[model samples]
Target: MSDTPQDSRRRYSAPVVDGVNKSAGRAMLRAVGFTDDDFRKPQVGIASTWSQVTPCNSHIDELAEVACQGADQAGGKGVIFNTITISDGIANGTEGMKYSLVSREVIADSIETVAACEGFDGLVAIGGCDKNMPGCLMGMARLNRPSVFVYGGTILPGDGHTDIVSVFEAVGAHAKGELSLIEVKQIEETAIPGPGACGGMYTANTMASAIEALGMSLPGSSAQNAVSNDKRADCAAAGAAVLELLAQDIKPSDIMTRAAFENAITLVIALGGSTNAVLHLIAMANTVGVALTLEDFTRLGKGVPVLADLRPSGHYMMSELVAIGGIQPLMKTLLEAGLLHGECLTVTGQTLADNLAGVAPYAAGQDIIRPLDNPIKPESHLRILYGNLAPEGAVAKITGKEGTRFAGTARVFGSEEEAQARILDGTVVAGDVLVIRYEGPRGGPGMREMLSPTSAIMGRGLGNDVALITDGRFSGGSHGFVVGHITPEAFDGGPLALVQDGDPIVIDAVADRIELQVDDQELERRRRAWQQPPPRYRRGVLAKYARTVSSASTGAVTDLPDTD
Candidate 1:
């Protein structure tokens, strides 16, 4: 009395394959290696974000094939599809970086479009870069399918503990005369050794860990090396796990609950993850129909502490952490400390507590993750701040080493390019608060990450001396006294637009406020004078994104209610 094959697994596939009216569809699938036996099986879409455009995702083609093999072995039909990916490392400072965040929307749209069009019942998305991870999750959430996300895995460290950030900082070092052009060239040549995401707890690794904690990815999936046997094994297991998920009828909606998102936030805090986690997590939650907000980060961050000493703020790379058992042990530690929700459902078809029950603790003499009693920071380094300058709130990564307070004169620039020029030429010096505006979601039409300028600031030896506030955002590798995702971005005439050169800007992390020290009357006068700039791109993806994207405070998603 077991369920028949058609009754058991062919919920969506039967309609596409079993009906005579759908002969064309079956015939087309047959050309792609679909047999009569394959027609009876459930279809699992394998979304591959593989390209040679960057080392971050160059190896994903192999991982996608492994996943397809896994599905085929597990009595499911696997169909592979390709999605577009943009390299943040390659696009960091130029106008091309404007497409970086836009690529997330494109990836999500493509995945959802293909899966739905082809009637995929379950999904396995393989992603390597920062946006690819979230884009996959968002697509799966929108589909409400039994989906599994696989991190493309952290890259191996470059020579000399270097990475993409090292290369970026080296450029600044050369500009500052700290290093010769040859030294900069040496770092640029050696920093990216092979295919994988940038080798740090940067956005790629950060989002991977966040997705796992959110229960959308397999345990230990975030910690493996991109080219290793373990990553291949993980990809295969993820494909097979989708069939198990389909059997249990557990979809992303069942896993990406509000409490589950809290677990993600908790882990993100404990690991000292990227500030991009703030933007991407909120966007993922929105896609899943979960009620998450910037304030949630503030609330969850108060109790959680930063334990990982990973770069760009600390001494180690994700590979080193992986060497000591990845984040599994750290997750177990957080679970025991009562910081994580033990009952949250994960992709394993078990509670998060169940997954951690068998996880062994980190080996002795490991300093990668600090003991809870003596944490890297007593609370989360990701501080959500609010004031006149950012009435809708902003995010700051203050590891306490930068001091909790910064009061300086504003060195205003209309764009990141302008700021970078000044910083490279030494026109931007210590105690100057660099205000790079009009680079927000609508303004930049993509909300670009400010890694180059921030790296330059650090490279110029002004890491602790200067501060940067941007309406745009920062890379996971960006550190120092930096604040980003300032709401009501300058394009929308937020307070960031009213500021002029020499204006006093105060960032108080201790109190969680960023104030522009101008009287209301004077601000109103400047506001009256401010004029909204013409759209940067008259037509194309950037223009469309500018037309539809929401505020950064609301995750900068494109599908929100049109308030305009």
Candidate 2:
């Protein structure tokens, strides 16, 4: 690929000789058939999160090529580099999930290190799936470079009649005995076959859209299908956008302002985004020296109505969302309602208002995205709860039901296995608060999703009437009044560690509180006697994870620095 006349002019106008090491730029230019004069051209770094194991991002290799074409066309040098790819499925039953959360920090650190070492003037982050997007953003925040995210986009809908179902639906059917063992296996296989359909608005799609709404990704890039030609075009455009960003000297710090973070939060709730987003966003915000807390999520949830009727919370998929118009259209809806931060800047060097032009009519025809006047839900689909149970805070996605406040006796289960066995045996009752503890960051170390237990409880026909409370995390596809990521987890002698079987518990989604009926004195006494479990692992990643991983409220990122 060669630079176009317009690209050459843009490069010539900016002259990338700012911030970067002039000597390093000259050395790289010499190696790439450029002279001292060409050293003035913008240098763009392509931080690619592609690995053999992460199928969701396996296509990033080709996407990087597309980005390179754009970079060259824009008269900039694009250096492609690799980072760690963490797959949630392959990490089941281990501390891999915890490690995966920390992978974002590692990835961000890696990108920063590479950019500093190579003296690249700008960055194009090619990320897909859960952790990579946030990881890239965190790194970019520190570097404050002219950077943009290129999401690999979600997978296409599945092939079979049943295969096309969302992750929640598929899991629900299997749990309810509607699908046989062989059929369930087939559905799972077909649903996540390679580059797409990696579940619903779970972590992957949620992170992608959140980043897009945060102004880190190109507008309309969040909903493209991974294999579609549009995604390739978006990648190419992202490549060109980086060069433009460099020329304009617009760094991530310029775009990722407080208003942009708020916009991202509003979009997260309106879209019924993943519970994991709450954690990741906080971590990303912190990287930029911004103060974001669980309270912020609660406040935003109350004002932002649920508009996107997508899976886990609703009936559509990302591909369907794309067909109806993607983030651009959704932003238009928010903008029209006066809900968006109109002045926020985007990677395209235009105000959010400018980028949203003509998107309203396109969204009007698509029912997937509802207008603000008639939203799917009146407020944010998520809530932050607090009380003796969650002193710091816990999150719950309350969308499908109304009047869900209830006080019930606790049915405490120390492990997921016990909870599953009891639910399957019909031991659960209506108005019971199912408390599963010792599954938090320090508890499970991996902080595994409590999907199986939550689904089993629902399958036993006790979903609505019964409330599920845990110190663990829940999948984005999971619905119901399930409380997750209770800080100061049971393993660390939090209030959850003091709950006894048959104790009364209360969950008031409207009041935003989760409380154990036991008095504070009794809870304190129980906490005094609580004993921590023996260490699950003596060495390796598990031990390191246990030692360094923070709570979910902090993005569950590792406390250690990236050595490489």
Candidate 3:
């Protein structure tokens, strides 16, 4: 009930300090012959994932200042540093993109190394893009330090009405000949204006929100707009919150519990979040020694309906979601419905129940976030399917499609380029299972998003009829009968490698199956003669990725030992 800022002073306060010489702080303790007085102060490390190349996180330079300000305000010494920034949109084709998935582990490894050397008591992670957020989470999860995640919020909506359209709509317009190349360029330029724009929700926003909902961030910190002044205030608040976490001895492992993960799942589904959230959340849960499988996602999603009608899934943008009420209102709705675990503790030392008490009631009528009784979707929009083709498992967004039953003759495309050629030539058929090969982890090294072919199929007026299956990943913005993350990708000699043209394939979502109608004997015969695709990279990171990356079922992380 204490709203006074002074109330936070005792719990969140840090000790005041006399300024130390820069040279003295930088000198190695052993080299400088440091005394007990120097070592007594707790050191805070600010790990920022920012690069000029990463447009989403370009503003982090300014964001870092707010974090430092908070640490200083809390009477702690803050040392800010930078790390690798991976952009999925920019590194689309090259081998550098494949490195994006594994880069999280690398960043985490680097953080652990740096923390060891610097001897910091806690850490503040500034991650705004897709890989950066998960990478930071993975690092903090392993380090098990008093840490907090500060996300650069979503970008403001664009000016043009066409620019305000969902990502899929903009892409669809370009494909359907409704938008010219010149217009598409303009939209692309304006759609993502510097740091914090519409693209924020695409992958970055989803993962950042996931971080908060998991209780890793201060409540209400995840949904702020990136370019707004409020973002700076939130950053400072997060910096102060980290110090409070240190005082409470609250570590990342303490907050990211099984129930916390369940809360994240609820939030993700309610937001109509990115499918990549599944991979990142599973990886994160694993870091805490919690087993979270795709089935768990299916089960949790079934009871939790899609409540937020945000971009790629619905009409409004994330900025609107924040202005209306932010995660506070969403969590309030979930708690009132008894959908959230009220006992969960956040970084602020407040229980989820207490946090809900602070949020104002949602306005009477806002179509942006639907209520529990009246959701955007009746059940969880995400579902996992299994069959001979995807025995381990494959995921599909049930809400992204129309008809549940699809039977088609497989139209095999050995590469994405080949698939594009067929679609552009108008040679693709309606009843076709467009099997894309050599694009999975071992195949393409990067496991590129499957937009090229999916966009083409939708453009040809064959979206409803076509079923695009790949041992690769897809953008969360993509919709339709697309099956992604097929395990044991073709280059790795999985069954998908043997699939040939004219083979019958059936996709039955209601039954949760993706079956290849070909006989076992024929498939076995074809599999025996199938030659593995040559290495995509003879040297460099792609070569390393092909050697170390795990299958899609395993979150596509590098198969490195957990030494940290």
Q: Pick the candidate with the highest TM-score.
A: 1
Candidate 3 C-alpha lDDT tens digits along 1-564: 113333232221122222254344434553534444434445567888777876678898889889977875886556687888776666643445666676776787777777655666778888877778888888888878788889877777665632223333555556667778887778766765556633424567788888888888877778888888888987888777777777778888888899999999888888888778877888788766777788888888778988877766467777888888787888888888887898998888888888778788779888888878888786776667888888888877656445777899998887767876776677787888889878887788777776656666665567788888888777665666888777778888877888989999998877888899988898889887888877968897778877887767767777434669
Q: TM per model? A: 0.98, 0.88, 0.89
Q: TM-score of predicted model 2?
A: 0.88
- Ranking under TM-score, best-scoring first? 1, 3, 2
Task: Report the poorest 10 consecutive residues by lDDT, candidate 2.
Answer: 161-170
The per-prediction CA RMSD against the true structure, in angstroms, equals 1.6, 4.5, 5.3
Pitting candidate 2 against candidate 3, the one with the higher TM-score is: 3
lDDT by residue (19-39, candidate 2, tens digit) is: 344455556557866665455
Badly placed stretches (over 4 Å) of model 3 are 1-39, 93-96, 161-176, 197-201, 459-461, 559-564
lDDT of every model, 2 decimals = 0.93, 0.76, 0.74
TM-score of 3: 0.89
Misplaced by over 4 Å in model 1 are 1-4, 561-564
Please identify which of the two predictions, 1 or 2, would achieve the higher lDDT against the true structure: 1
Candidate 1 accuracy as lDDT:
0.93
Q: Distance (Å) between predicted and true CA of 210, model 1?
A: 0.6
Query: Clashing pairs in model 3?
Result: 98-446, 155-196, 155-197
